[model samples]
Target: MTVPANVAAALPQYDLGAEIGRGGMGVVYAAVHRPLGRAVAVKRLPGVPASDERMSARFAHEARLLARLDHPHIVPVYDYVQDRGEHLLVMEKLDGGTVWSKFTGSGVTPAWSCAFGLAMLSGLHAAHEAGVLHLDVKPKNLLFTAGGVLKVADFGISQVVSEGATLGTHGGQVLGTPAYLSPEQALGNPLSPAADVYGAATVLYELLSGRLPFDGGGGALAMIQRHVHHQPRPLVEVPEPLARVIMRGIERDPRARYRNAETFAVDLAGAAAGVFGRDWLLRLGAPIHLSPQVAAATTRPTATPPVVRETLDIPVRATLAEAGTTPVRLGAETLVPAARVLAPPAPARWFALAAALAAAAMIAVPLATPGRDLPVHSADLSKPVTLGLGDPTTAHLTLTAAGITLADVPATAPDPADPNPAAAGPTSPLTFELPGASRWIVGGAAVATVTADGKSADYSLQPVTHPLVSIMGAGSAVLLLFALAYLESVLRSVRRRRAGTGAVVVAAPLGFGLGVAVWLLASVLLRHAPDLWPALVCGALGAAAAVCTVVAARRSALR
Candidate 1:
């Protein structure tokens, strides 16, 4: 192919090499500073008319705008020069490809997406302080260095937002990627730094939810119309705190978003810390494996960064579904994402599914004696009764009879969990004694009833827990809770297939205790005919509590 005149032009001071990258407005060449011998990427601004004062002014203005910004997250300009009628900008050469390249194959996660937002906004915040608005803020323009540092790039289409200011060659027109365009910018109205914030938020929503906010698939004009009138999908599908911050950023009215990029960063920092610990941010970027073509385009040798396997320990309450399921590896040569394997179904489930697990253990430990059977005890007269086993479990009654007196018991007498007075201490092979010519059935097929002198009193009973039964019950419950928690995590994963939510680092311990408690309460209240029915009812309640604990945390009540 013939060399274009713009590419052939000589700038004697800098040595330009092969064209490594090309875009609509210019071609990027690997260049070196002649005197300093420093490597840089030189961008040639082509198609400028020699007599166009406005274009000339815009070129010079672009130089000044790029020169003023000084932030680690921004691609810095090294030199600006004009050769013949062509203009060129020498900038820091990034060996790691654009953010766009990373997402084309393996998808981006929410934590890393927020991490990019934090870094990208820092640059935008600096630009706004310098009075410039990055009209185009999309994934294609965001770049990552070889060190995995994400930077906001491509200010060629940006403009200064200062009053009555005309800085670049955009010429007062709609400027930005169509999919991420702000409502005001799409309408050809004046731009603000908030518009950039809107653009950044759109990118975040896409990462977190895994779909374009409004993907009408309509061409350019249709996109502008949609942005002007249509609202994006709800962010509620994602986890809390993080979702709240994103929704505010993409609000249709600029006034509703964080007033400045700095404010938005503050909110973002809190959310990233809440959902994914602050130290885990690096893991988000480490999973991305750039294509060889993208890496070869850079100025240096590329080594695919090691997949960060450093397990992100999300405090049980703070995090949700993890991306541990097999990652969709791009190709054999391309590196796979971090393997986030969850706690495999807990060992508790093997026993939890059957009531006999606990009942059998209870009987086995207490020593079964061919099983004794007794008739149902019932009476129509006032009476008192006492029931006992090898171990003592409190029996609560609605009426005072014999040595049995109503005594108040603490909700957690045995350490904050025993809310039933009826279960004072009744154990295996229970025996019942009735007073005042009344009848009582203890540990029998019949519900214990005491009646005397044409008066009757009945009381609901707490399961007479054995020491072994309590130990085994607790173990079974923990496993049951784990199974429930894992199910919840799976549900969240399916729901957030678009966005990569974190994993269940520590299954909700508090929720587990609550689930066991609910199960106990339910079992006591459900004194059904078949022994299996009561156990099944209580188990269902426990499972519900475990699942709800996770669902309630991920979902917002107000939303």
Candidate 2:
């Protein structure tokens, strides 16, 4: 798409060149600062209507917050522009390609991957400390300078988590890429620093193993489900200690994972030193900056002789065809384990419980309690007419034969400077048109539809979402979660050769109380929503609680 006229006019100082990148967030262009004779990248956000004060404020706030980050491994923002109808961020430009382009096929060493992870995690930590989250962390966002130094770029989707609010997501849609999503993110639950660490771990895993942890054949939703329910495939031909560090970062439960990026970096450094020697980073010759704690951890001397391995044949992208019995050596004299033994499969009992819960939800959802019909409302379309007037949560729609539009009511009074008072009213601040035969908005799980013909319209709310469904779904999910948690505890006890009778005794009442509490909470919060939202919220919470408890129990068991 061509740049809008306003966007082009907004950046007078920069000579805009060819488009360098484009994605859902916005478009990026290569530009040169006319005064400084330096190249920079300009990211242009889509135009916000003049009336959209909320969005305008949000855009300006986020842009300024991102510009404050000044770490060596982070791409520095030079300036931010908010013109008549455009938003642009100007940042320093690097000529070297992305990390994906650099190491996709070439055989790079474990030392190299470790060094890369250190730098990437350090950058991520800096952002975290500054209350910014690089929600979208992937190889494509890892850019290299001409000198081969890696810098984390593209904070396009990064959210400023200040106080307790963020703009990471719009509506209910997921924001980050599907492949790198943490379990909490995949479930649309509240996010924490662990999410970025998960992304970093996924990247490190792919760089070393040449495949994603959950690289099954599927679309985005399927991939998300896998991350929620499946254990990652064991790392192969990687040093045992390094693999453990990576695995902990990618844990399904966010709490079980690294709490912050620096902790992950420290663990990674120690693991790298154990496998590659204390001076591994120095030997790799990569400009990886580590914190003092991490540097101190890395200084712990290794018993093994220092080995610097570099070879064109070292598989940077290990594939199925490369799987063999040959031991992966670090250098001429160093040796480590050939592969990590496969982790035992998940207990069958847990799978049975999950499958049963899945079956029950599938059967009950289609049979949700029917909705009560609200009074049928009519609108006179000749003048601007508001729909769903009393209920402010739903969108105010401007219906037309072409489609429907989401509009806000004009701020109470007319503009005094207008030529004609009749046409003096302002348009909705958040207005967008969609072309279709019928346009519908969902509240909870129920759909509200307004049909227009020429000048008049009629609308009704469908009864798809009801309190009964919410209670049923929420109660079931909570029970399931608690049941799994109890089972995990019992399983852990059994593995340790203990009786575990306490878990069995407390499971029923604990599950029942938790389920009832969740059901009541959901009923109160989603009373008006009346559709799918109650169940969805409860399910996301239940899944999060269940996974955290189970994972924690399992880890405690191992200990």
Candidate 3:
């Protein structure tokens, strides 16, 4: 197909620098927004048959969908315009390439693959929450920026779910990439969130292993059949945690997969947190199977040891049998020839000196010293309290206490003076302030103990004091200073090792010392100032630490 002249004219405004990518649906160009001084990606959809109104409508629908989606991990659609019977969608131009490119070429690392998968899952979850589904989700649609932010792009085949609206049916459409299609989508069933979940898993699998789960020379139909009938090869080589997550995600039955993108993200997060085996399976609400593969993976032979099972732990035993050999069951306590052994901690006597010193410190420290009690007294109800309920009809409360204070109270209270006080019971635990006292008083304490009739039965309120909270805050500052110093020393050593002894190492010590000084100054201010000044001081110190660390790291990297 020849490039339309009118489309060519619209391209100049975008300062069409070069054609970056092209697909059956559209042609993406690298363009410069000259006036705004920024680069952008301009995707222009070519004119299709006017007879096929369904295709035209779907294309327009995609433009609308892209406009509505505004998320950090989603490619932002800047402007959508039509020129010369062609539609153009301008988007934020990212310098880095697509996940597809990485998957096909030098495969991404496990950490990066997991990270990218998690980010894409987050974006998909956001779209799902907004009642939109990217019908076609694949590696090609995932992009990476120069700053390492992963973005989901190309919502060309997305479907918007609205109240009382049926699924897209024009031209008998079955929209999705075949390799990543959910079983329902492959079978041309009405779509749901599970479709996206399946597609995401396929993309994740590709990202991790640089290969698709199913591939055949028999073409798209064959691949679809495989998706519908055949089980995917178990992701045994991949990390067990990730493998388990992917397996669940690509389950043959849509119902067996994650219910939604959010749930999938939660499982992915668990996998990333290194939870595996039966424990992780239980967390995922899946049944556990003691498979031979699992046993082999967990067990390894060592020269110096015969394996011994830990107390209350189950040991998996297996033996290679000859063609006619009979199987035998071994007792739980029976030690096999080549079993792996686990050991318990050494006796407490080994650390006797350390324990004695710790005991001495505990004894020397004063448990408690009599200090002025920060009295928390209840309201003096003897006087005309004149409690005013904000909404009297709703039975709102107005507590007028003297010395007692309420922490973490709701903003509005129900009307306590309501004729129908039953409504207030639900919205009880209201908090109010004293007329001239410094402390805030809480209402509805009686409701917690008894009903409005005030009969104490089974309720308890304990006073919580954190005298060590401030002390810990101070200790944190000191630890931070020491950490910085230690980090500087490590960096210095690293530089000396890598670039030789004479290499310049100036920023580390300087940054660490400056951080320590700022922390000390902030601590002093915190001790002197009243109110929430301590919190502010801590925040300032934290910000300073972050800035210093970043700057120092950048400088060191440059060196």
Please report the candidate that would top lDDT against the real structure: 2
For candidate 2, report its TM-score. Answer: 0.55
User: Candidate 2 residues 14-60, lDDT tens each?
Assistant: 78888888765668888899999999999877543223576567667
List the candidates' TM-scores in order: 0.49, 0.55, 0.47
Q: lDDT tens string, model 3, 411-493?
A: 24445587866546543443333233212122212111222222222222211222123332344456656655754664554
lDDT scores in order: 0.54, 0.62, 0.53
The candidate 2 region of ten consecutive residues with least summed lDDT is: 335-344
After TM-score superposition, the amount by which residue 369's alpha carbon in candidate 3 deviates from its true location, in angstroms, is 99
Clashes of 1: 21
Name the lDDT value of residue 302 in candidate 1. Answer: 18
lDDT of 1 by residue, 1-559 (tens): 3335554565666677778776545678887777989888887775643346766667678788888788887889987877677777789878888766655445555556666677788778888888878878888788878788777877876777776343233433344567788887776666678888999988887666545677544345677678779877676435556667788998888888888887777676666655555454445544322223322222221132223222222101111233443333221111223223212233333323432343333223212222113232333222322432222233322322112432322111122355764444433323343333222211112233333233333443323433113322344455556665665665454343211122222333433343443333223223221233333434444444444433433332111
**Model with the higher TM-score, candidate 1 or 3:** 1
Q: Select the stronger candidate by lDDT from 2 and 3.
A: 2
